[model samples]
Target: MKSILTKPSSRIYGATRQAPGSKSISNRILLLSSLTPTKTQLKDLLNSEDTNIMINATYAFGARVQRSQPEWSIHKLTLLTSKHSELFLGNSGTSARSLSAMLSCYQGNYFLYGLQRIHERPLQDMLFSLRTIGTNIKHLFRPSCLPLFIRPLATVKDSIRVLLDGSTSSQYITALLMVLPMYKRKLGKGITLLIHSIVTSKPYVTMTLLLLERLGMIVHRYGWKLFSTCIIANRYTGPSFCIEMDISSASYYLILGLVNRSNLKLLSICLYNVQGDFFLVCILKRMGCSILVSRSDVSIYKQARKLLPLRIACHSIPDVSMVLLIVTLITACSISLSGIRSWRLKETDRLLAMTMELRKLGVVVECGIDFISAYSLPTSHLNKDSTININTYGDHRIAMCFAVISSQGVNVRIMNHQCINKTFPSFYYVFNSLAG
Candidate 1:
């Protein structure tokens, strides 16, 4: 495995950078744009493996995608030319789940498969829901896993209702929200999604609903258990859309600025409630970090070396939890995160990966079924210039979070550092440029 060893910089200075486009928003918008026949230009789309998977998936489905780096024009294909096709989604939960659901609603036989890790992730919830909605689907490999086949609609009903468990992942909810409107348009019937439990990653589902509204789909909600979209003549339509900068991606820098005591400005960030990860600012405030938020930027600086401890539920911000773990070491404050049972279903077992890596730093870490608690050791206990080897496990978040540990005067050798290409391809470039 190729590894990159990052050492602590002797000096930290003020710097400004714009994070990559929001992966959540970018992928959501990409799938939504393809569902409609109207030609759309997506501005500031994230150029990463996952978004590229969505782009390729759409193109395979007949959308004419013309790429111009950050900007891509997509002309949605109006009809299906082939009856059978196979697609590969490389461990991208958003791409695999959402795209599979979208394909199920269409008239085709889709043999969806992906890398080994993608197969290991949970898909039973999504598969069960599709079967409930009268879609013909079969698990071609291990039962309730990926390497599945979705046949043409076996039956069309007057009212399509699928009972889905939201406790695992919200992409299931997002997938249904994006596809149901198209189902309504095609079947001349309303769609209802009955969420069986409290939705995990509720904020991500909110992101999807917001985008659905932008595409002219009005989804009526009955608390968290139910979402209904009344049948309408209007089809999905968005001529042009702009994706926001990735708030989750900016989280590494936010914690870095605090730990390194650097004056850093994150540009092109809109202080919006749409992305749950943007709540990191609130966490920073609780940590006693000096944070200034303007219209389009967030400036972070260290107020004090010692900081208050934190215990947060990570269900809404699972992707940010890895970075938050690093904060414990930098601040010498206890940080406990809960509601992260879904971590097991991600690219790798993040809960386990983080626990193992933290223990290597001599920090006391405890992990449970849905929680991880890290009690910090004093900064004096850390051996400065000591190199710690981090196995990235091919998970992007794991690699990026550990990279920031170098800011704390500890060197980190991150294996498979290129795992970041899954989301933030420019992570190391931006990280290196911020040092003086």
Candidate 2:
């Protein structure tokens, strides 16, 4: 699991096994549990690197959590003493933002820091919204970014509304909602927050709403763009919330089923999900893959297609870009993907990394300041290098994305094989197991 991958000269010829609970869902549920005042139990929560870091950070931030067997219990914080405590956010952005927003709403002096790159990442938009609402947050470096110092606002008058930039991260909006519930429930007055923007990655916001509703709270969404709701402070008994298997994580395997032309049976695939990433199924169908969605599962198989010149706007489904990008690579076809501009701010500079890494395979990629378009031609260049060593850039998506390149039978070496730990720690094994 730790070695650099060496791609074979022939087809990787295999099937794929899937990972469990979505990391995105895991982080959101963790935040929900922390905000809920009563004991809420979480079931099927991801125990992966990122979610685990979130779990530890949650307890560190003063949320009492207990894990036993298949259920985990959470006791919310009445008062998270915020006195100059330096909180390490690790590499989990959801944990960092959601937790930071929570701490800001609480009365305290807290220094917010994260994994080195996380501190380097910007949080200004969210920070400014928090500060505007009168929470204590200071940027040691810039105005709207991370490496923040949050000093408690003693006289912050309990309620405020702010705007969120849709082009940026939806996490900012999610962070606002996460804090809004608490301020409404515990603090003096309930806040009515109105967010106006062309929201992207609209599924994530849906995930937040869905989880909140499951916790027995109410919230409203106007289409996928506007969210307005009041979370009444209630005695929450954290009932067992089963985490959904990651559809995004299953994408690579779905692609494998098509690419390998294998005879593996598809079972229990979730297609009708409020999770926005489910659109991946539509995108695949467009590309001429044979996919059937049954009541029990979804199956994807290969077919002959007039592979269109795909110009996809991926801003709504950032996490699935890896598989899409690789699919473009296989077709030797031209693909222009947009709406993914914010992908630059992901765990890695996704735009630049995707372009540079694909170029190593002798494919031509042209990336604009905000978009990336690539085209590969039919060529006999599979074994020119015999082994392609690609850097993961510390982003898990990049690592898994390139793993597909090996399907063509080219020995691809991944610089940091462990990066997949962010969402799917057992990705390599699960993938290779299909080879058996």
Candidate 3:
């Protein structure tokens, strides 16, 4: 459906839902496994548009993939021909950035293009680092944008080093890191990465480092800024791996329960995940939501009479901040989230999209490059009787977060509702189930 209308509810109660696998871990593992000569079987990989893009890209790069429900076998071909190839990555930033770096290592003519919005996202910072290592790239349309041709030179450096500005996006750092073993094998030594400025998403980079460590690669660091991997494994060789549940997706339901004062239980909740968005639980607790966490389940219900006004930095939990912003509207409480400049670089310009939409709901919204604050406006400025139509701007998180308004006695119409396919394809099914 292009649009979905959710009817208002008095309250929601007694519901349970299973969280999806982590998209970050799933994509990283998909690429890492395809680089290994050994066969790697991944269990519980997220079945979504973003992961499917990675899967198709791996197959296009000559990796053999066998699909079995809940398990996928990926075997890297002994030889990947340096033939001409064209890859079309949807608006998945993870796929576009990481695949660009990985394809740069191969001596081939590869054409890369994506959807319209993806073309607007920044690729210049990552391309500059790749070009420093002698990777040939031609930007087709705009500078620092997508629709490009990449051809690596037919030479291998004996030793290599490059500098990256850490504040750009953690995905750029992760893109280079994931392709390090290939450089290590070709160069006969580990490549050194000199990072300048503060890393924007340190937790995500930590996730990359942890995954590299899982592949038995030894990354040595001088203090926190400089990183280099030991030439231990020329290729990854993990036989089988399980992906952790996505805490980002879980935040939607948890916040839904808090807004509706409902009894909701989330299944397969992992407390020890490397995903930084797990901090949502702590944020909810701080907001006075009654939450109970156990080995594999989390329960949320009514406890607090009201959600407290929150002022918090969103650098570590950028993905779920959309739902937190929605909480500001549902509870009619003030919320100010900072350190989210990266949102401007996501699938859509989230900072601008959010500000515009919040204003439509009679919220007094204020925003800059790095922060957004919202509070309910005066009663005279409110439109209390009409349904709110939320334009999602094709951002999956925006569509999902606005769906929660139904529980707050507001009818909500979500435009481009199918955009949730980018991450959680079954979101509406689950949301409707919980709404029953």
Which candidate's TM-score is highest? Answer: 1
C-alpha lDDT score of every prediction, in listed order: 0.83, 0.71, 0.83
- Badly placed stretches (over 4 Å) of model 3 are 154-159, 377-385
User: lDDT of candidate 1?
Assistant: 0.83
Model 2 regions lying over 4 Å from their true place: 1-3, 6-16, 64-84, 222-226, 263-268, 378-380
Clash totals in order: 0, 14, 0
Worst 10 residues of 2 by lDDT: 9-18
- What TM-score does structure 2 among the candidates reach? 0.91
**Weakest lDDT window of 10 consecutive positions for candidate 3:** 377-386
lDDT of model number 3? 0.83
lDDT of 3 by residue, 1-436 (tens): 4898875665776887888899999999998887777888888889999999998888756687788887888988856744688889999999999999998888788988989999999888888888878788888999968898888665556667878887879999999988877777776666888898788878898899888888878677676589887856555676688888888888889997777666899988857778888888888888888888888888987576777889999887788877888877777779999999999999899999999998888778999989999998433344547778999999999998888777766778999898999999998878777665
lDDT of 2 at 50: 83
What's the lDDT for candidate 2? 0.71
TM-score versus the correct structure, for each prediction: 0.96, 0.91, 0.95
Instruction: Return the clash pairs for model 1, or none.
Output: none
Tens digits of per-residue lDDT for model 1, 117-221: 998887888888888778887887788778888878887766678799999898888888888777777777777899989899988988888888877778888
